[model samples]
Target: MRVGKKLFPYPVLNNSKNNSGFGDSNYQLMITITQNENYFIIEKAYVEVENQDIERMLADGRAKAIMVVECSATVFREKYEIGIEPKDISIPIGNLNDKVEISSFIYANQDIEHFNSNDFLEDFADFDFSIEKYDILAVDDGYTTKVVFDEDKDKKMSSIFSVIKSNNKDLNVMTVSSENKQIVIEMPSQYFDYHDNMKHNDNFQNIFFAIIAIPALTQCLQEIKECFSDVYSMDINEVMNDKTWFVSIANRYQAVFGTELTSDEFIDCNTYEVAQKLLNCGSTKAIEDFYNLLWNGRSDSDDE
Candidate 1:
């Protein structure tokens, strides 16, 4: 989220020069990233330019906005094209363990002779000059952001877990595990393939989460209860403090119930109630979506 002034060698749009009549308000760059397990870091990037001259240049291919990303941890660096239309980008998440630095700039797409802009400084505003290709015209402040691979309590279920095939023949449906913060749902190979194929459907997503997360959360709460059966003697922080998964589930319990997870109310609650609270009664939504899918057949078109 870096937004500030940057120094450039050439006379470009910036906040420094007096009478430039151009500043950050005239140009802006925005970038957002989403982590997809260990596969790729997806980026949605775009730039905003208020100046009509710059907009015309971009529209006619005289100028281009570019996003420059660098990750020291992974030793990865790459440049991407960006503009008014949002750009979807993906970079392989290979050993990407630390902060990623991102910077953006608008560059001359080709040589421009007699470049003149009403937004330019007084001296340059009326003068026409030759600008070489690849010359920087505008720059955005640089910043750093991190990508997390571990499943903390703050992350969503999608980020916290992945589905994989189970080698065990006796296992029927699915089982959950939160190992090394890479939570996984393991099922028999056949069921695993089915789950993978159908999990992307919005309706199936709600149903799958209900079936897997509820039971997993219930079992997790039971472990906490067994380990600290005496609520009075329980120090919530001390119980499974070393296990991130345990701490995450405990935090979720408190989040849902609005009380310490080791409190008497939590201890007295039954498995069903605990599941309901943990999921915030997610099953209700599942049922609603299920009925919609069955009756509506997933069509958004109105019958004219």
Candidate 2:
């Protein structure tokens, strides 16, 4: 995405040497995304350029603005002109995955010889400079937002539990470590090998979630609850400042439920509620998927 810079020879709106004559002029572009059904909806896509000169240029058809959106994961790239095209667009979820970056820019649609704005700097007020086509007059880096579908969320259990393999033959079947931010669950070689091998299989993944992730998360939440038992006076953020996993889950909780819990609520909430918020009902989803996978497999075998 193009960012406003000092590449232009003349005093552009964003240039450091831009004259104050274009008083109180600013450029802002905002783009936000939301998900609905099978589409990623662009909730907002608008540019607010507070400059009369630029507005006049746009009105006179000298300048054109466009918003560009790209999602590398799905190899989707599209652009919409500010006034000429629809701003709020919907992209099929099939055409999107992971991070979506949006950027907007205003540029000269056609070359203009001896272009000079009335608000040019004092030294160059009377001077004129040739403007070339596609010369960026203004730009906003815009913003990036993530799109996580149900399938994607189901596969993101690793964020809450950092499961690793333990090579020591004498170690317990599983060990939980919270010394670092993430709650690391170390499993002996045999169990870890089984998990690692079948992690990609949808049915096996559902089974692992039902067996391993649920129990590990339950324990992790219990430890957090106990850690703050005596410090109910302090904020949860302060108490778990070092535990990034807690922060991750808290943010996810808010994203899923559209509300943040008070520190007291975090401490007082039951383990089941905490689990639901943290996992976005992932446990129930896993159970359903597991049943479906088993039932579908049996039916296929019976048909054969």
Candidate 3:
């Protein structure tokens, strides 16, 4: 609505019944301005259903100004639904009870989409706005996954680009590495047991791989095996064999590789290195070895 030299915007009031007869504008935009210290604030911007008591609310010392907008049948919720801009404005007032809510009730509950916030600002309130759309970047993987957002995702070493890598449970398998940006992958190898309760088609840990995150770096399967083999040289006593899983890996290396690799050799190595060997050792053999180790470890502990 246009006042002497100012224009105020309001919600697209739908289905309002015009009562005051001024072009049947049909709705009212009620604004209560309050003062805190030296500045003025839009304490509340409400949609009043009726315009009967306008003079009484504004005539008081505390109330600043009120406007009536003609939209449809829409009204602001009673609990002061919308947020005001400028946080606090420059309208100084003498009303001590200016903070007290005048317009108590409104019509409906509306979201941010339904209302334009600029309308509530006082004439001097300066506001600026712009819109942003994200650009897409394609990885080597043929975009089977839906892209929620793909901008500035260089894993870590970037000041401009920012990407959110969430644990995407919608995928069959989740591939987490030591890196912050992990992938929801569906390869033949499964490294993480994060989805153990869920059923998946590719749960096989069939290849030895390291979860190294240098952009576009692929797995060096042979290097992983050498790390595991090098670990075989470690003394049996220094190895961390407190866990039950180590016994199985030691037993499995002896059974499948036909080499007397003790738990000290296997458990003493880094986790990724051991994971690589477990992957290259074939999923079937690794699972069988795990169970056998689990059982054999129990038997040995009981014997002692």
Report the error of model 2 at residue 92, Å: 1.6
Better of 1 and 3 by TM-score: 1
Query: What's the CA error at residue 44 for candidate 3, in Å?
Result: 91
Poorest 10 consecutive residues of model 2 by lDDT? 295-304
Ranking by lDDT: 2, 1, 3
lDDT tens readout by residue for model 2, 225-255? 7877766566665544456566567766677
TM-score, cand. 3 vs. native: 0.19
Error of 1 at 120 (Å): 1.6
Model 3: residue 202 alpha-carbon error in angstroms: 5.9
**Candidates' lDDT values, in order?**
0.65, 0.68, 0.29
Best by lDDT: 2
Task: Please identify which of the two predictions, 1 or 3, would achieve the higher lDDT against the true structure.
Answer: 1
Scored against the true structure, residue 59 in model 3 reaches a CA lDDT of 36
Error of 2 at 132 (Å): 1.1
For candidate 3, the 10 contiguous residues with the lowest summed lDDT are 135-144
Clashing pairs in 2: none
**Candidate 3: residue 217 lDDT (0-100):** 19
In terms of TM-score, the best-performing candidate is 2
Error of 2 at 15 (Å): 12
